[model samples]
Target: MELTWLELFIIVLASFRLTRLLVYDQITQFIRSPFFDEVEEEDEFGQKETYLVPKNRGIRGFFGQLLSCHWCTGVWCAIFICALFFVYYSIAFPLLLVLAVAGLASIIEVIVQKWLED
Candidate 1:
């Protein structure tokens, strides 16, 4: 099946947003809390950042590693979204639209924040 440019754009945006939601968003912390531990680390500049360390072995560790890395999660998210879109376009379109809109809104929000900061 061939994907049109618009469909491709939607899939990419949806994947990106979904990956971010799974890996970085506070709303999904409960899901990650079981597999990973949050560790606070200080940089040379004395800035502290929270990091997720895998807390289990085997399957749980695999999931923990997957959930903690944006690049790894994004690949899976893109594959999952694309496969769903191809197999169930009617059902997936609405979800994809929501994710795409949210992703665009998030990018715009970041841009506006940076503009304001400048």
Candidate 2:
């Protein structure tokens, strides 16, 4: 099945937001908490930041590492979104639409924040 430009754009944004939701959003902390531990570390500038430390050594560790890395998670999210779009467009479209809108909003929010900061 071929996608129009708009559908491709939606898939990209939906994947982006889904990846962010899984990897960085506070609301999904519970999902990550099972595989990782939150550890606070001090940077060179003396600023403390929380990081996810994997809590296991085999399959669990693999999954924890996958969930924590944005690029890793994004690739899977893109594949999942694209697969679902191809296999179940009617069911996936509404959810993809929501995620795409959210993704666009998130991009705008970051840009605006940086613009204001400068």
Candidate 3:
């Protein structure tokens, strides 16, 4: 479907939020997995740290895989974004815009860091 500038902007913002939430949000906390383990991990800024991560198992491991992948999350997020827009565009519009901008800033930060490193 053809989208106006505003709709396109909303989709961009909402997509950012969707990608971020499914990958980094607290929703993953509620999922218990047999392969869950915590290990030392370095922060993006180069600080040493640790975090819990889940290992992919058999075919049943799809949920874990989905939760761990931002791209995969993005697809689901896109679907939700559209649904939210259709259901309540007024409220969803600003909310997604704010969250999506935050997500975009994060991406820019990483890109800038990589550029500096290179």
Residue 67's lDDT in candidate 3? 65
| Clashing pairs in model 2, backbone N/Cα/C closer than 3 A | none
Q: Write the per-residue lDDT of candidate 3 for residues 1-118, one digit (tens) a residue.
A: 4669977776877688667665666765555344355679788899989766666577436666776677887888888888887788888878778877877787889899999999
In candidate 1, the residue pairs with backbone N, CA or C atoms under 3 Å apart (3 or more residues apart, or in different chains) clash, namely none
Give the higher-TM-score candidate: 1 or 2.
Answer: 2
Q: How do all models score by TM-score?
A: 0.87, 0.88, 0.62
Best by lDDT: 2
Q: Can you write out model 1's per-residue Cα lDDT over 46-81, one digit (the tens) per residue?
A: 999997798779888999989878999999999999
- In model 1, state the lDDT of residue 48: 100
Q: Please report, as a residue range, the 10-residue window in candidate 2 with the lowest summed lDDT.
A: 51-60
lDDT of each: 0.92, 0.94, 0.73
- CA lDDT for candidate 3: 0.73
Runs of candidate 2 exceeding 4 Å displacement: 40-50
For every candidate in turn, the CA RMSD to the true structure comes to 2.6, 2.3, 5.8
User: What is the per-residue lDDT of model 2 for residues 35-114, given as tens digits with 9 covering 90 to 100?
Assistant: 89879999999999997798778877888989979999999999999999999999999999999999999999999999
Highest TM-score, which number?
A: 2
